[model samples]
Target: MSSNPGQEGAVAHHEHESREHASHEDAGIGRFFFGHVPEGVHGGLKQYGLLAIFLAIITFVEFVIILPEDLRGSSIVIAPLVILSVIKFFCVVAFFMHLKFEHGLLWQIFVAGLVLGLIVAIALVLLFGVFRPTPRAFSEGRQQPFVHHVEEAPHYEPLVVPTPAPLGAIAPAPAAGAAAGASPGQQIFMGAGGCSACHAIEGLAVGALGPDLTHIATVAESRVPGQSAEDYIRESIVEPDAYTVTAADEGIDQDFQQGLMVATTSSLGLTDEDVDELVEYLMTLR
Candidate 1:
């Protein structure tokens, strides 16, 4: 049987139409999902594998950086880790999330969202004083003064009158006035002054947020060229930012961060007497 030319032309036309329709549908789907990908930019399996390898290497480096105790405690390790993390984040978002292939408007939106999230996180941290150390109460109530009890003599000697010695012996200087105990300054330190929040004293306050004040009195005079120990202690309470402490100064593992202490004594509700008491107590740490 001979084929008809008209029928053959009709079949060919139908096939062409079907192919065009399928092509249009595929192009529409691609635009919907990937947005407008620029020419010559392709994310294939090989590219993904390379990114994965890069990320793994970064992770390994981060792990290695934190292995040393001293480095881990210092900002030298923290800063590099933060930078590496940000790089990894961008790589994942641009390639895996296809943000790089998408429109500029999507990128703008993503960046705005990221900036807003960071602002909120920082605000919350400040509001909650997350980095500030909390003051601890050393005792529930005022500590009792230590008293030395003297035991009664085992047996009283029978009454015997001895002649009194001649006057002007000076009575041994009244036994040096029986060393005074537990000053009001100590109370303020453990209470209103909030000194225990950031400072540490060997057998007293245990706070570790700021410098170790165990020997603050001994070192205070040398901290400034002309400042006395009492003056230094007083100034530290009134104007905390006047001088900053470092690891070298304190012979410690890490330096105390600046601006962590309350800016003013008023913020702590410390009166002049309270401050004085706190200074006195701290000076006695030596």
Candidate 2:
């Protein structure tokens, strides 16, 4: 049967439009991101430009957030920064990286790799306890006090206080300038306390991560204005988040982190006396 001419023309026109649409879709992300389209020429440039501009705006905002006062220690900073960073990562990879145009198998591989990398990074950070509170740095004079020490051989045992016993049970107080028979506090510091890993108490712990406690007592009284040396030392042990050791000019003050030292203290089941001995030992550092 002969088809109507009008109907035939209509069918052809419809097919041409379908082909044009498919061509546009197949253009890929590169054309969307970098290809310049002539003004008034209809293509994906407008869509691409909008998305690109959006990503740019996000980056600019991240920098702007840094300039605001109270940026540090702000409750709202974490979520916004993390969420924005993730969004930017996705946008860049999906469009700018052309992952959206890749085959399904390749796309899945890229996605899996990204997730695995994040997992490994988080695991390593946790394993090393970097997320825990970091101790402040000790920046005092070059002179160090001479103290005889027990040889730990640079090995640190994970702190394991079996039970939170009464203060006297941990260890009795040592005599002044006691050089023999290390106390329970010293055991905690070198053995399970993990303080030795970051602190250098002259011939004792020898840790370089934290301040040199060799003279911590000398300046502890002056460090906190009106606070007593004993009080400052106690705060450093139990509440590392309370103070921050920014740089070398801070004397014996240490860098502060949120849960690091708290986790350490809590994990050890330190009793009142354990802390007392630790404080007493710290005071002798002068």
Candidate 3:
């Protein structure tokens, strides 16, 4: 039997329409999940795979940058890490989130939200004085204090305490002067206080998170007007935000953010005597 040409044509056209409908459905689903793709761009698995690789490479670089202890401590390392983070953030938002394909009101809304968030962040930092630094303390003339070191002996000497004399017995005379020894403040700073974790003191603590305190004693007196060095140092230990130190004060090139130091003395479990001793020892730095 011979087929009709018009009937054959009709069947072919119907199959064509079915395929077109399927294609539209697939595209719609893609747009719903992965977002709309801009013209001239092949929003395919291959393109997304490449983007994933790029993001992975950036993350690896960031990880490697902080792997070294020296680089971790240097201020120069912060900028690159921040830049990479921003790049990653932008890429994820623009491509993965399909924000780049959006236009008009959507873009405006996004930009406005970003700006408002940044403003709020900056305001919070200022209100909390997180980056605020006290005035620089300049030292004009000051002498370095003497540090006493005792010679090593085979046996350690025991501390002696005077006993009360019997009713009829005579009391022993006290020694004229005590022997010079290591500073108690130095012991606490190096051992229990944990000041060395963020502060650097030449030949002692080697922390880089905070300012260098090699000559803090010489500059302490000049930190606050009319405030004595002892008072300033004590306040700094108990209330770290009372006087924040800048990168310039630490002789560094970067801007040292304040509030990185722990704000309370209770955090260090320091007592009034420990604070006094720590201040006294720091005063001897000059």
Candidate 4:
């Protein structure tokens, strides 16, 4: 049947309306993902070049402040560094990541995560001393003074000692100078060894996760073939599972299961020099 001309016109109008609606929907989606750059946004960005310059300067200052050795352990240095890091983080989030234009819900989620992390850190500081073990005076290596030292050698000598030598002097008479020979080892123990954080002995400071190892070398030796006491300790730090002494055997109450000590080869990024220092210091535990 032939359609009336008016009806044909109405059908064409409906089709045109449908096409227009589709076009509007498509435009809306495009705008949501790729925000429209205004006709002269480039000019506005040029005007905002000062913002970029200021940000660059801030970054440079942060780097310079952090690079100086004197800034280490200084509140003056740490405070600015933290502030710069926070600023940088926000800048990237706002500009590069476009978080500034994001919905409030997303921002809330991000802020919540940051707050939670800070809370956990504070809690750790209260409970476990900032997620760091307390440094022991004497760690797996190094000897302390006034501790019971019963030797099982042929003589079975019992040497009662007073306070250790001054921080600079050697306790025993050794050919190697105390300060010069043991300096690297001490640095490694404090740095790479990750000691001096928790445990405390009369002379040395080491993490308290384990026992004070003052005279560990003299008191403890390796039962395994081809392994010295020094080797045993180093291996234990690198891989705690390679050797395991029962808590009862070690005269400790806590029984260490598998995977107790976290491997820090990746985290601390120990170099050969660092390892050597650590080994040298550990051997001096006697």
TM-score top scorer: 1
Per-model TM-score on C-alpha atoms = 0.40, 0.37, 0.38, 0.33
Candidate 4 error regions (>4 Å): 1-182, 198-201, 223-226, 263-265
Ranking of all predicted structures according to lDDT, beginning with the best and ending with the worst: 1, 3, 2, 4
Ranking of predictions according to TM-score:
1, 3, 2, 4
Clashing pairs in 1: none
Q: In candidate 3, how many Å is residue 251 off?
A: 3.5
lDDT of 3 by residue, 71-183 (tens): 78577999999999988887786667655544334555776799899999989878655565322222212233344685554353443332322212211111111113557
What lDDT is obtained when candidate 3 is compared to the true structure?
0.62
Off by over 4 Å in 1: 1-182, 264-266
Regarding lDDT, does 2 or 3 come out ahead? 3
Candidate 3 regions exceeding 4 Å error are 1-181, 263-266
Q: Give the range where candidate 1 is weakest over 10 consecutive residues by summed lDDT.
A: 170-179
Write one digit per residue (lDDT tens) for candidate 1, span 1-286.
2222332232223222222222211122224434433332343577889889999999999999999987676888889999999989987987777565444456668778999999999987776556553323433233444446955544434433223221122122211221145577765654445565556677665567778788888989899889999999899878888998888987776677787675423465667887787787778877
Q: Report how far residue 167 has shifted in candidate 4, in Å.
A: 23
Q: Per-model C-alpha lDDT, please?
A: 0.63, 0.60, 0.62, 0.54
